[model samples]
Target: MSASSSVAAGRGAPRQASGALWQALPFLGIFAAALILPMVSNDYWTLIATRAAIYWVLVSALNLVVGFAGQLAIGWVAMLTLGAYTTSVLVAGNVMPPVPVFPALGVAALVGGVFGFIVGLPALRLRTFYFAMTTLGFATIVTQVALAWQGVTGGGIGIVGPVLPAPFDTIFGFYLFCLGLAAFCTWISANAAHSRFGRSLVAIRDAEVAAESSGISKPRLLGAVFLFAGAMAGIAGGLFATLQSYISPEAFTFDLSVLFFIAILIGGRGSILGPFIATIVLTWLPEFAAPLVAWSTFLYAALLLAIVLLVPGGIAALLDFRSRRRIEADRTIVPRPELLPEILGGRKASEAITLKDIVLSFGGVRAVDGLDLTIEPGAVHGLIGPNGSGKTTTLNVICGFYRPETGSVTVDGEPLPAAAPQTRAASGIARTFQTPKLIGEASVLQNVMVGGAIRGRGSFVESLLALPRHRQDEAMLRHDALLALRCVGLGALADVRADRLQHSELRFLEIARALMLRPRFLLLDEPAAGLSAEEIRSLGGLIRAISRQGTGVLLVEHHADLIFEICDQVTVLNLGRELAAGTPAEIRAHPEVVSAYLGS
Candidate 1:
């Protein structure tokens, strides 16, 4: 297990490991059973298995976004719809002036991914219901367009899709074809859930704001999820069209979206086995419901309601439940004494984070009023005044979370934006919040993977397709993320959940994440405010090493004792302004500093 892909949890994190594989066994058995399914050999059974497998692929694709990433997607069927319709049009013998069928299917999937990317771009700006509403609108719009377009989409007439020429005609051949696609997709989705890219999705899903501040680009990560999910939906759709030997606008409707959600929830969100269970049960549901067909609706509704009300987190939670000790054993959080010094060395800095003519205001408050200052790169710079000294406000302005009213923030001539947070981060400015803003449910490795993506390549499409280049790039990022955790002395805690870490560890982990952006400069809000004396000294040293490496680091620490002991230079703020800037010794002796410290 390289650092980036480890499973994390321990101590405070409740037991989850024992249940994971125990639930997975059924899938193993099912796969084994499926091998014998083809042996049943009869056309009737083969066709049923084929249908189940096709839906299985659909469920798996939805799982990537809806389950693992925890994003509610109702429009998943849209991509599949695009794939089926595109394939129908291209192979219709009249559209596109003629093209081979297989290439058409491939083209259909690619086109679906492209369209899905367009839909997801808007998701970056919205969240929760707003996000869901945006996707739903997209689904509704596409359906209306398909319904209205008579010439290309065949209007309400639908489409008579092309068939596989010779080798793919029989049920056996078709079953094998669908099985091949389902198997490939299942492997892709499952492996991804355990890999760096998948971890990034989980991080974004868990908390977009924290992920962005930690150097993970929210737009790109979300887009990657959308593209991968879309490709899977497209692949499944094409197969469904082939299987039915026909398709229509009605085939991809609002209810299909609901079905996708139900499968993930019932199967277990974030579990590899969840989709399989959901798919099997759903594929056979109508037949099973046939016996009680009249009362079945009532019974089904009651059962689904019970499942939702009782096991809210999903079936994966129930199936993967295990004894506490076993769960603790799986996550390797520990003392990790060997890594302490390297972490300590990272803080001992010599330069300051400087803001010249910095200004910010809300209405007329002038929260930060023309702040002029420099924080020595490796020094513990303190911004202190009475209440609302604009300490936190200053941090926000420098990191680009808020646009300053005026003045430029320059770090060795690398100017920061007055507005855009992302652009500032790309220029090597990274920061943390007073609150530990981490994705609580995701593993430590996963959260850090989001941080590490700054160095990765390939847009959403390439990664979903598992192009050789993207795969290689992901592997490299994983290696780098692990190395970063190790540098901060959190290697053993790689698999631990961020929410489960000791408060100090969470603080360290945040800095570790910031480092993963490979920033030439770091802006730490307050790393020592919550730590003990030993931890404070450790923070001091860490700042120094980061400075020594030529990466400027600016720290705002409240603990003047720690600050004075470690900072080569210090700048103090009073009444929303820079009181003074100088070497630690000079400031400590200055009359104004003496008054500020003594409260004279």
Candidate 2:
């Protein structure tokens, strides 16, 4: 059945919050266990728990980069070591009187952020193993420097971290402090996993071009993530130094780097609590297996291999199997109509997009040659031509995906910044690709939510904190996304994964996503490439509806019948140059267009 028709029949109401509560029950149980264990455990066990808490903080931080952002950062230990050394040197060298615990923690965070920014700046440009190797180099350098810097770090011996103030001086107090800090870190990590920043990171990780087009700044967000993660790692390091009352170069080894790296892998990437649990188990597992001390390294290696091979998604994925099913089964959603006007009325005043003398070439081929087009608000302008006529290239240039070798693009009579895709998108241009560009793993709703990102709902900080602004923005985005989905007749399947969508559904979903942006202009590449005649008719109606909402649509399509039936104006291209420009009727009658594109 058609998704919307099924929705009208009331077949897809969202499931209750009970499903969500059930999913979270295990984590709540774990939290309760964590609290009670400290109260009942012996001193040795308590110490191990405390150490696990510290590593939990570090592992969670690393997860943001490796798990969420998909940046393989192995140099986090450097930040951790930096925090330890910075705190120890300050207190031990008497550079400052042994500050209170909170203040010491603050200092460690600052140290971590500073070094993290430095490392992230250069590393953001590289991807995959190259980035990993860069981080590995940074870790090596930091470890070597700690060993060599005798005056500051006490050479290989290392300086001592300051003890906590009187109230926290006892072992129980320290353990409590570690537990509280770990809990705070967990909260932040969990918040980030659902925040705008998190979504943006995942978008970038999955599709860089799509993320950029959605107005996400790759470098800025990544740098911020690295800085935040680094600060957290540093905090963990500072806490560890205080817990042990000692620090040394030998302690922060490449092996330590491997451990932190493995913790996230064994737990699962992109999960907040998964890595937290992995950190605890990995931290204490060796202590429990004291008899296998000599084989500990081999055992860890085996475990890593096992997790990577047998359960590549890690323990969290296994636990989340049921939750995944619940997510898939969730179709109980009410239609949101309030956001219709907000999305439809994208442009208040009349706006026009003008492309003048545009020329874009790749190597020796002139993809778009001296193309001039005008798109008026409240109109559909179709650009049609034979294969390789540069229809898509022209749209790319206008939307800032490709910079023209020599030309200018103006929106509402002002020069549009075509230097970056994000800039163009922010300036009221949104686009859909020839092939549907959607985050496969993300739900249909989430794919649309990405479009609403340009609406300026909240800041990164507000998103992370889940503040009122963030909630308000999220609510608005969700409402608008539903409206957009309904507009394209896919509201019933909003909860479905984008990858599971049929080709026709995907095309409509892409249009719905673009509409969520409430864009002044839309660059649509082949909206009817693979659709039935009925679907094409539906798309034409949707395009006209969008035009009525005052959105200027630049459609690059080959479906001549659909284009002629709906387009207010049409521009025909052939061999990188304009073949004809006029109303659909005029273009159809043009001799040159018929010979070149229409094959008369």
Candidate 3:
């Protein structure tokens, strides 16, 4: 074989950074202050820092949805109420006034999470401004209920919560508790940002429909993130309420929700330290400048807006780029000695995917009717059809993006349920879109990393703990992702954001993303739709290499000549029906195929 190309070096290419601090010294100072509160300060300072830490978690928690998941939530204050009441009801044994601490904190986390789930239900049926309105409306109703139902919430004044348990009563004890919880929330949020679960959130944000096709359940994943965020926010609220010995609707407001949005936009959306940095500045600057506090708040707002408009990547992109680059550069990459016999990589001619008698209906229209097809292992099967002949519809049904009205989709001889798209993907199927769909808001590497979510030593726990094995596994995956990007001629642009890629490069990037799945079979829909002749030639070579390696590739292409040159077998479709299926030579000579091509 001609020298096999290895993109090991390309995978480690350096990335340009926005030059912001990756790790914040200021946050480190705050962290140290939190742990040593009683030793250095009196009761008042300790309480202030404690409350600040709690607010820090609030912003971080909200970021999961508004920042990372790309959903705007205006009812976040409701979480505070849910948390305070849940904790009060559980630990405050004095049923008369309800005033206990420890158990309440734990229960608050749980109850708040449950309530968040309930509140998030509307997210399933709503999106964009409608979802925002729903959340805002819910928050308004919840606040009204809290105020009107004074019997439980102590009326407009709110409830006077009890002190925590024995150890927690002391300033040091309470300070340590607040700090630890804040740290825990930060660590978990950061890990989720890097883990498979986190990538799923980004995927959902980028494109919910595409995310489903890639095997991520939209509702379940969205609920999980919301629940997780709710729990964290509840902890913060519970702690803040306990520190002050009071809770009320007056304390939480819509302004707080807007502030979190501004903070994430300024500090960076995905970084753990972003919220900490933004919260500290927002919380302290006004306090220190009490004389002109309102004006100070206005200034902060202006600063946040300027950052969003100018340095859109936020502080995390500016600060962490070099650190991530240095880390990526220090790893070694080894090309597999032999490509494996899997869908995304490693294959030799074999039968892996087969489609028989597939039919797709969109209400009144028949997109695909009685489509019979078989894709063998190590074969490049080209699907050719005239306008509206249903090539994409066939791919959609097979991938579970659309369920066929009357047909079965089988992978390796097993039929998958229509609703289970992720199951279909997990069954070893991967695909690229005609229009590239990726999480553009995320880092270039993270966008592809979403597909490299196979489980191994790098468990979610390992990533959270930053363990040795997890780091190693993460390094390996990053290397492989870069290599895959280069395989499709996108090596130089590995670190460039997908949204910023040129037209031709976008096509390659889409294929690069699918390759991250390590699929057993792949479906390429119009991979050459917008490519020039030169790009198309290179793309043809790639299909051949993929076929030679034993990967079964089903390609849907509009360019008839390119299909003939690249595909080993060709299937022609007309009016949603398979007109002919044969080798390229046979297809070129068929009378019926000619008639379809030239008009019968």
How much lDDT does each candidate structure score? 0.69, 0.80, 0.71
What's the lDDT for residue 69 in model 1? 68
Considering every candidate listed, which one attains the maximal TM-score?
Answer: 2
lDDT of 2 at 252: 83
lDDT of 1 by residue, 491-592 (tens): 777676666677888887888777777666677777886787777767777666666665666667777777677666677777677777787778778898
- Give Cα distance to truth, residue 110, candidate 1, Å: 3.3
Q: After superposition, how far is residue 68 of candidate 3 from its true place, in Å?
A: 1.2
The whole-model C-alpha lDDT of candidate 3 against the native structure comes to: 0.71
Instruction: Give the worst 10-residue stretch by lDDT in candidate 1.
Output: 4-13
Residues 404-504, model 3: lDDT tens digits: 77877776678877766777667767888877887765656767766766533565456656688776666666766666765776665556656665677
Candidate 2 residue-wise lDDT, 1-600, digit = tens: 235444633432244235446656766777678788867888888888888888888887778888878888876789989888877776665565656666777888998988888888765578788988888899999989988988778888777776877667887888888888777777777777766677778788887777788888888888888888888888888888888788888888676787788888788865776777788888888888989977766887999999989988897777755335534333322323343455675356656899899998889998888988999988999999989989888877876778889999998788877767888777778889987878776778888888777675677677767789887676667766777898788887877768777788888888888887778888889988888787788788778777777788888888899989999999988888988899999988898888877876
Pick out the ten consecutive residues of candidate 3 with the lowest summed lDDT: 328-337
Pick by TM-score: 1 or 2, better one: 2
